[model samples]
Target: MSYVWTLGEQFEGKLRGVSFELLARGKKLAEELDTKVCSLILGHNISDEDLEELIQRGADEVYFVDDPRLADFQNETYSNVISDLINQYHPHIVLAAATTIGRVVMPYVAIKVNTGLTADCTQLEIQPETKLLLQTRPAIGGNIMATIKTPDHMPQMATVRPKSSRPLDKDPSRSGKIQRIVLKDELVDTRAKVIEFRTDDAGFVNIEEADVVVAGGKGLKQAANVKLVEDLAKQLDGVVGASRQAIDRGWLSYPHQVGLSGKTISATLLLTAGISGSIQYLAGIKTCENIVAINNDPEANIFGVSDFGIVGDLFEVLPLLTQKLAQAKK
Candidate 1:
């Protein structure tokens, strides 16, 4: 039985932070199962130095399938190659980040292999007696958490949310082997071509990746007041986040919403204003290290979970905080 993690893209010419996060989690599971943690990388121009990073992060072995066809990610090709690799190795468990690529590729591979896959898993465990992979995720509109296992399948599969776990400290002394595989020519197929790739150059704060997140809820009273939230975020060099109700009110775009139905955040500091702290809303910010909330209502639910709670009007608090932050920066 082997624990396998799928690699994601690089940040600043290094492995994606999420890849290291998954590897650290995989290492713990592998240790419990007394097996090796393996990583699978499929891309064009993959270098040995990058491969070594995986080993340093805790992978016992790294599997590489370098092909020009894989230079750009295509659903059909990635799905086919991954499904083939699963069939060949028959690993006990496979994990991927719940990013755009993982969400697409893993589902296709699951269907191809006829196995069950739990998406956006919050927790993974190995059953002590049976050595079965136990996958836990939110269900029923985040009202309940469901634990699932693949009893009938050879390899239990799951896609974990990014930033849900911390990466292990890099040990330069750790070493591992790289196994290069030659993908069959017939496996590569392009049903749809990416003619051009365009990304929005506009400043958009991805709350999930933000180290500091400043969020506002419905307590601002009017949509126009959301700018206070935005202004504070900007002053702090942080991203803007909104509750589901704020999004519903059209005060902010859906991309900026953070909650169970929205993006989960693992920011170092999370500052919220006017949010009443619905259970669903709290779920998304659970990973945040420090939480500070401001609400005019002293009884607001947000105060219960907040590390520091301010009982005051957000209209008054936001401006003061923003000014203080700006002055501190100067």
Candidate 2:
């Protein structure tokens, strides 16, 4: 049977949250196409419980490659293995997270399999009549959203944005087949070797995973004023995000940037201070549940998408808002 395949991602022997998110999306597309949803993962010493969790989430089948060499992500070895599997199994569609590993490996695999790939896709749907995968993503620097399809390719491919969708609740009764794949020496061997992995100690919460994000923009005027944004985020037990302008000014690190070229977030509450929402900035936060904008201009673009708007000087408004929230907690 044709399958909607999702490439599962693992880090340090644990599956990343995006893996389950892809499975959820894959399940929907699979149902629309009348196919099964399959998950493929490559790692070293991954537990059977984790493999079973894939089934519980949404995967109807799980294929995993377990080897010490597969633990750290190597571009050539991973791409070759995935490409070979696609050629052998001939899945109807393939989905992967648009992460660092997925970004590096998927293009190579798509080229090897001779298929087009849509990167950073925000939405996916199966065309009713043709069963083609419709990949929707921001185009022209996030000014427009384009829907693309690979009509000629055997297996359609897409790298979905992380946090763009939530995972299905785990169902303990769900059952699926689990298969272990053993590859030849040549497929697992690669010239490139990972010397060591270094983690950045930036001392900031991962905004993509944050439930609440307080963002600042150019209107903050100076880097010192960014502390207000940080303070408010702390009050809400959340992380701080920034517009591209704030990042450009060196007020915040690139990791804190939210926009077309930066990270996409799906926070429950996104509070923006002094940000005039550009289309690029809006695209990143479109999935947020509630948006509150604090800007002096009543016609600020941010107010248009905001659930609540405060038209006043954020310099004055933020301190009072922060004080009130703190008092409420006390």
Candidate 3:
């Protein structure tokens, strides 16, 4: 039987949020193609409850490989297992999150399986006539969106960006089958050993995962003014974001950059000052919930997409807003 499969990712025994998001996307595509949605997870010591959560979210079948050797994310082993699974099952389509793991493992799997892969797709759809997986992603420095399709490949593979779509609410009544798979010793063998893992404490919040982001653009005028953005973000219990222009001027670090060339954020609230929203910047925040723009020029492009627009100087507006939030806090 044909199946639409989503590769689930886990860290330290708990499933990542992107797993459910991919399942939600898979469910829609499976329905369109008249196939069942299956979720494949590879990890050690994964809980049964977590496996069951896949069904509650939207998978018709959950196939998991739990082995001690597969504990950490070893690219060689992961690519081997995933490629072997695709070979054995011959799924019609494969979806994974475009996170660090996905970006690293998917290309290897695609090469091993002799199939094409589209990375960092923002949108996915099943073409009605041919039932092809249409993968849409930014190209040419985010100036144009390119739609790709693997017409001849058995499993059309794509890695979608996290927060590109929301996961469906859990349904306790949803019933599905969970199966355990055992891989051959050869598949689990790896050449490299992960001796230790280290985290970078750069003191910069991951803007892509923030619930609220207050960004400054070139309109902030100088590096010192970036503090204004940081202060307001601090007041709102949010993280600071920056447009490409701001980052280009070295007002903020690259980690805080929000755009197609940088990171795509799905914050609940996005507030921008002095940013004349270019299409590249807009693509990064297309999924954001509420957008507020502040620009001295009323004709600024950012105002077009903003739910609230303020035609005033950011230097004047930011301090007042920050003070008001501070006063409200007191």
Query: Whole-model lDDT, candidate 2?
Result: 0.91
* Candidate 3: clashing pairs of residues: none
Q: What lDDT score goes with residue 25 in model 1?
A: 78
Best by TM-score: 2
TM-score to native of every candidate shown: 0.86, 0.90, 0.85
Model 3 agreement with the true structure over 1-330: per-residue lDDT tens digits: 889999999988899889999999999999998899999999989999999999999999999988888878999899999999999989999999988899999999999999999988889999988989999987664457899999998799999978778888999999999999886799865578988875555647678767899999999999999999989999999999999999999888888899978888878899999999998898788767899999999888888889999999999999999999999999
* Candidate with maximal lDDT: 2
List, residue by residue over 172-271, the lDDT tens digit for candidate 1: 9998888988877888877878576554546466688677899999998888998998899899788889999999998887888899889887788899
lDDT at 289, model 3: 86
Task: Predict model 1's lDDT versus the native.
Answer: 0.83
Worst 10 residues of 1 by lDDT: 5-14
State how far residue 177 of model 1 sits from its true place (Å).
1.5
TM-score, predicted candidate 2 vs. hidden true structure: 0.90
